[model samples]
Target: MARVSQEHLDARRRQILDGAAVCFARNGFHATSMQDVLKEVDLSAGAVYRYFSGKDALIAAIVGEVLDQVHEGFEEGARSTPPPPPDALLASVLSRVLATKESVTVDGRPAFPRLIVQVWTETLRNDELAAVLREGYGVVQRTWARIVEAYQDAGMMRPDVTPDHVARTMMASAMGFLAQQALFGPAPVEVLRDGLRGLMSVPDRGAGSQSG
Candidate 1:
């Protein structure tokens, strides 16, 4: 009985988050009222409040869910047995980012990316949301930096540069592309891959040596 109740509770939370995502994606976060979210969920006021304290709480939960999905994809890529070569790892990461499963929709339009943009917009307005965004981005930054370090250690990435530099460049590029795609639905993933291939390429350490 207790276990069943727990399962039902978890499902209800996800339902609320899903409803909130749809609402925020449509109206933008600051403009979206709790009443709007309630309308989206079609649930009793008390029931919804039980899961989230208020609008901020619900938005925080939605942000948490998005960051979790991003982290999961990173973990899945980082799991290649024997570890993937640098190019392979970067390729797989880009492939995973462009995965269609990330797109949730309302009324046939993609909502997830829009929701993320809305969340970012709110982060500047709400201190709590800013903290949450910072924490989540910190996790992502460290994860990518570790992967970059690994590539550098293997001599599969350029030397003379810190892992932070490589990680920041790749992360910034990927995120910028996401923001662009969210607003404009720009070019395919191949364009990004092609662009990054040279930036991430392994430098020949012995290129300047006199080999006679």
Candidate 2:
């Protein structure tokens, strides 16, 4: 048998994941069995199993991919700049995130949003998934919290605002926006940028700045 090339393998894996994402979006994870995934991809059992052992594995990959995409967007922007102004900093990262999630997947569905929400909903009933989901969020929360603190240190953000509070609030807002987009399709990037601009607004803290 001719050896499978790395590009082909990666493409195949992505194809399976994309199909699984669509199936999960259309039918609840529990309701959609491996057979459903098989149908989604139009692949034989052997071919499907080659990529994912079962639904749990597929769901894990889906959630993992979503988390990685969001994390990459933040890490990329944060690492490339020297703690840029909070407004510019956030604009860069948030725009990357909006673009990343809105990009089309191999299956022609939006890369994220609805698919992520579906897996999130499944976590309510799935202990394993919930654990993974929590872990993923914890990492994101900490990373963003540090960014919040950095902004404070730079005098660009209000020092009185707890880092965790700001970070969590931003995260919650992003999640809410994602849920909305998932249900109703893509939202204008301007609305998101405007929201972030408001959230990250840094009041002038010149000489004798008041914290009240």
lDDT for each residue of candidate 2 in 1-212, tens digit (9 for 90 to 100)? 99999999898888888788777776667788888888878989999898888999999987887778777666654554346654455556656765744544524656467776877788888999999989988888787777777777667676877888876876777778778877777676567667667755655567466455
Give each model a TM-score: 0.80, 0.83
Residue 205, candidate 2: alpha-carbon lDDT? 60
Q: What's the lDDT for residue 33 in model 1?
A: 93
- Alpha-carbon deviation at 207 in model 1, angstroms: 10
Top candidate when judged by TM-score against the true structure: 2
Candidate 1, residues 112-206, lDDT tens digits: the string is: 66777788788777999899889887887777777766666677565767877766776677777668867886456666776677655657678
Model 2: per-residue Cα lDDT at residue 211: 53
